[model samples]
Target chain A: MERILFGDNQFFAVNHISDEKSRAQAIKFKDDSAIIKVLDDAMAAGINTFMCTTHDRIANICDVIRDNPKKYKDFKIYPCMPYAHKYANAVTELGIVGTLKQYVPGNFFGSLFKGGVAYINKDFISIMELLVDAEMKMFKGINTPVIFLQNVITDLLLGLGMNELLIAFAKHVESKYNAEAGFITMNLPKLLSVLEEGGIKNPIICASINKVNFRMSGGKELYEEVLKQGRCRVIAMQVLGGGAIPPKEALEYVANLPNVESILFGASSKQNIQNTVETIKYHDNQRVLVE
Target chain B: MLKVALIGAGKMGISHLSILGAHPDVEIVGVCDTSKIVSDVLEKYSGFSCYTDYLKMVDTTKPDAVFVAVPTKFHYKMVKDLLDRNIHVFSEKPFCLNPTESNELFLLAKKKGLVNQVGYHNKFVGTFQEVKKLVKEGFIGEPQHFLGEAYGPVVIKKKSETWRSDPNEGGGCLMDYASHVIDLINDILSPINSCKGAMLKSIYSKQVDDAVYALVGIESGTTGVISVNWSDETYRKMSTSVTIIGSKGKIVSDANELKVYFKSDEHPKGYSKGWNVKYVTDLTEEVNFYLRGEEYSSQIDYFVKAVQGEVPNTVNTFESAWKTDLSISIIKNNSK
Candidate 1:
């Protein structure tokens, strides 16, 4: 039986962390608190698995795990590293020039600079070198399984040309770093087709259902296609469309999707977490309309 | 009580037909188009009779209100003929091939006291409306600079020696597409000082430019950049985004979405992220508001209301003429 995992995807806003200093603080403050609450709430609700992205947030999450290893002894926390190489130059430039204020605040720049210290002053090529360096450092001492979450939006915008660099990066991380690397995408058919074309040997590809209009088409197709792939497990996120979906429907849809190994959701408050648990238990066996 | 006839059974005509078909106060008595196939299809779909000759259709139908969805080149003659028959007109964009012809239509409409409206749907998009509201509310402080871009790959694949491809036939991205954004710029900015742009044939090798880029300077000292291009893919690449940078904050409305960001003193703990983004959903509200009608069942509603003296014609002939003039000037200067 594929286990249903519950966690919030809400960390520091990925786009908001414009600079390294703010990114580091956000890592220490916002992301740290959000992950702790998400994991604590999931454990209380009998959910053993928690999934999140690997941005600056992961550093703080790893710190928390190291500090309170006993509290998370029984829980499995999966941190997916976001593919940041595409805009690494832009992000790093914003950090150094301090013009990050044009887009966001000063703290955001500080966090990004601190979190991205190794690549803060590096050029585009050197940024890539740092990404490989960070990947190596992350794999060296980490005993827990690290699932690097590869996002496609940056790839599409940065002209990485989709699936080519993505597959190569996944293969490198898996083979070179010996980490469990998988492709996560909003486009299921394209991702699966690319994986097949690239001959990706990784066994755990996941997909997320994002956007309100796409909730029906993308969400349903992703649920079924992941099962069909069989080699890869599915991780579903954005269950609420950033709090747009009706609460009851959100829980039921996540619980009922066949072959879904885990569902990641974000909560702004304690009640939001409790309410999700209640909504999931409300319709235990009865099939409900997938929102 | 006014009877209405629709010319051109294309997308806009059918949309108007559906609205007029449902209005309790109006009667969509007839429809006309050059293509018997198109007329027959729309006639069957709308359950109305279709005619080939517009003059004959108008005479036979005796429509008090006529919606002209014909090509821009035909707008001058068709509108002139309709107004000569004392019929009010609701025509689609590119009111005329040039400003002079558009001015003639305006004068003719005025002489006949006929209600006239040109289609500029982007002005009615909810996000733009909200941005206008934010500008009024000083949410983004004093609006200083405005930039807009509207680009799309041309949808009509088979370009014949059609008028749209001919500069004389209102065939350019500026007139066909940029008019919406231009109208929006006029609506938001007061006292237009000067409008200048470069119209280039960047993408296609046709007679007319496939892309146009222009700079509009409002009398308010707010400079704006406008870009219109026809190099978009099969999907609609039309994006009407406006960013007004003010001293206090900024207000932006992309036709795809709308948002206004400003620095707040209160700074609620969580709200520190930035200005919250809100999606606008109601298109009808703005349409009806501009039409000065309680409800807009069809574009015909505005035409009928203007004809019956129920509301002042929101889009007068002068505005249409000005839009045409501005479009022609921008295209002529930019086509380097």
Candidate 2:
């Protein structure tokens, strides 16, 4: 029986904390106490895989692990760095001014000019360059096997004007970063396509099993397609439709999927963690019929 | 093996005719409709006798069961007449105009011991069954709340105000559209203790609301909200989703998609994520069940089963009366 590897993404925040300042503050606070607590709890349940976003969060978490390295000697942490540079043009074009213009339209150009040249410096383009530089610097000698998480493909399809561009960006990342990193997070279709491009021998694709618009095909059809392609490994997440399914059933449903290496579950509370452990244990005992 | 007569050579009626025609144990003996052209077309397509008058057809064919797929207004008289002739009757939804009429039919069916069934196809849908299983397993902890929304715009001809558009003819979004949601709620959330709903006249400004919304409280104190409309321009979108927010976890059944998210004690994370597809096999099992007649196959099957004494009238006249009565009461309360 293959072991069911478990992990939670973004462990510190109670809710979906996306703001850079708050996220930075969360990890750096008190030597990253919040992340340590989550990691310690996870390790105790025989789940040692840790995934985090951004270099600061990873550094803070690593610092905590190093404080008592022997305590987490057996644990492994996988950091996810954002590939924000890929959408540099789109992000840079609509900076603070564009965002402001959306809410309060009409004299955005006047407001921009009045705000001075410093406002233009804060555009998405400048920010993207800065972020890419920071990321490149962060990636150097980052010998740890990291997984890069990308944004939703649907958004890219509608917003980016071309699917080929998205595909090219993914391919570029794989070729450039394959030696240093482990795999890229993506859906089943994108994962197979990326594998066909052939830079990374093994790319990890994170597929969601939830009620989202991206799932145009049936669950069975999607699963069958992935299995037939047999290209790229996959991590199944969102089995329960983002807290929509009951925990037990969600676990069972996910555990039943074919060729799933690990499942990423979101735990907001301590009790949820305990329940998840129990559910995994129960699933481990049952025979999963993978056709 | 029982012989069945189908009335109303419409889309739904034709579906029944084809299905029944293929059933080894059941035979479609006759088909009746107001339009002679439609009746002839259906009869030729289905290889069954055609009739201009349903009464004459029923008397001649002497079918063991009669399937009423005509308009809701015609259901009362047709079903009543069928029951009087000691023939079992199965009718499409909106059993009658009001609960009183539905109850009257129910009493008659009961006295005659005729098998009766209403078409609530969602009850037999596979996704709903899966959600039910998850709920029973305590997946979403103790389900405290549920919310559902279903909307779509099916083309309706202008100036031809069909029975579905007229409130008196059992035509309206609430009756024609929201009826499925109501039945779905009943199937998934058993024993709804009390329901307090509001029917808004949002979109269509004619006889009834083109959009309808409702809030129901189940016996277990679990609250549910349902929103339905026929105003969406999208092609035939029917989403009957139920979100069960429980004490321990949450379960969302967004149509065929089921998702569960819960907190775990272990902090496991990695980007070495791969996509694995999980096929919902139970759906196929449900389709087989309905096709096999092990589960009720709409009203016609129920009528046949009732006549054969294989199963007691599970959906008797009273149940229809009660459902319609509840619907009317809900509508009346909303009007007030």
Candidate 3:
């Protein structure tokens, strides 16, 4: 896991605080060139990992990156699955049957439709695999070291107390994609316990770990308890607590944590990327010196 | 444990079921849905008794409480039936298609002395809750005006005939998006008394208003703006925010964060006079089980506690949700 991972929220217009900023992002990232430019900027700033959702527009971004394989050689993309909003938006625009037709891995639909229907209609595991395969189609040939189940599905499955599905997701991602499955969740303590109980040792989990405990379900104390146990590889995201904490403070808090091997941040400019990378490097160096 | 049965297996239904299944006070005995495949999957995996007929499931399970997550049109009949059976009910919001019927349900729930609630989850959001707290504590003293706005990408293109696009089914920006903002405003500041210059614009949908804009009179003797649009593609998801400007200072809050400005250096409520920014994490207490957000689980937990007599059947009761429905009705009538 890279110490700093870039996120695709800025490109996809996902500002949590300001609608104005999100609208501006929607306008700014209208071109694939602009997105490519930012990726290049992150790479230039010595950050190589891009953690992103499998939104349809991301395919275009992947196409540009694939075209310039030489430039993006060391760059890694962590693709998150089941881009929930695309299906939701599609249902609104194309209706259910049409949306299914649009997304059901079109060419292989003929071959896999029977197994898929049985899985969804009668049982469940194969249906998840189909969705993953459909979502992972866009990132073909890219060095996707980790595939993430987005928090929306992850937390729901966690709450359902269905640990087998979580285990299945990890196993499926490993078996099919040759990538480690990273579960992005709001509840880190509970998810880590469930994964471990399900016999998934040292699973890769990304969650909100911040100074102010933003989005860290079960709160700061429970997160600290789990992280100290060192049972799982934790990727600390929303380190700024959804832009609440200052960068220095947020990075310092995360850099000093036990199991946080990575820090994920989304920024639009070259300077911001450089600043985040430099600040993280500084805090990490400071922590190493103290330890 | 309190025996509970779910009446719908839609998206919201499944969410509530998961939370309830994990709830310490809850024992989910029956899972009812109209879909065969959904019921089959749930029955196989979750091991809950699944049924196609909700009435049969209710009769067999004998649940102390029922969570109704069906669409708006069926909400009235199903919730009414459940209430008549002397069962506690928690229905998903836009409580009823008609405000008068909603009021009647409120009265019935009160008369029956049943613990009832509506799924207005924003009230459970910590940032919004912080806003309500600050308003009540006079941190922003005597709020003079407010701007309640909600935007989302629901109907960006003209395509389908889902319940969301049907006016009769309580679908549109007014019912789907604006109702949330109106409910938050009704609780956070003051209940909306009247609506003026309401404009329901159909940017995409033919039968439903895709955007709603109006000046609403609050019970606090001030007018505020209610601006909501479901056709905005810029927002990644539904975003609701409220801005309250008062005599002492101001407050602007969304689901994620809260920012307040104070005019005096008094440091009321341990907040600085100039400006204080508080994230949802600061306001939200830890929940036993967490899902998409703390609010979703917390709202259900509050209802469960209320049902168990550990807490009062206050926040987001049938009365408040009916008020939100009335506000929606007011906006719709004036938009005409």
Q: Pick the candidate with the highest lDDT.
A: 3
Worst 10 residues of 2 chain A by lDDT: A13-22
Best by DockQ: 3
**What tier of docking accuracy does candidate 3 attain?**
acceptable
* lDDT (tens digit, per residue) of candidate 1 on A208-230: 55334232223454446556556
Distance from true location, Cα of A256 in model 1, Å: 17
- TM-score of every candidate: 0.53, 0.49, 0.92
lDDT of each: 0.58, 0.55, 0.85
Stretch of 10 with least lDDT, candidate 1 chain B: B286-295
TM-score of chain B of 1: 0.83
Per-residue CA lDDT of model 1 for B22-114, tens digit only, reads: 455677778888754445444433457789899999988899888887678888899999999998788888788777788788888877787
- lDDT per residue as tens, model 3, B137-230: 8877888999999988888777767778888887888887899999999998878879877999999898988999999998878899999998
Task: Quote model 3's TM-score.
Answer: 0.92
**Candidate ordering by TM-score (highest first):** 3, 1, 2
Query: Which candidate should be chosen as best, given TM-score against the real structure?
Result: 3
**What would the per-residue lDDT of candidate 2 be over residues A74-172, giving only the tens digit for each residue?**
665454545332232122223323423333334544565587644443342333333333544443444334444443322222121223333444454
The weakest ten consecutive residues by lDDT in model 3 chain B span: B36-45
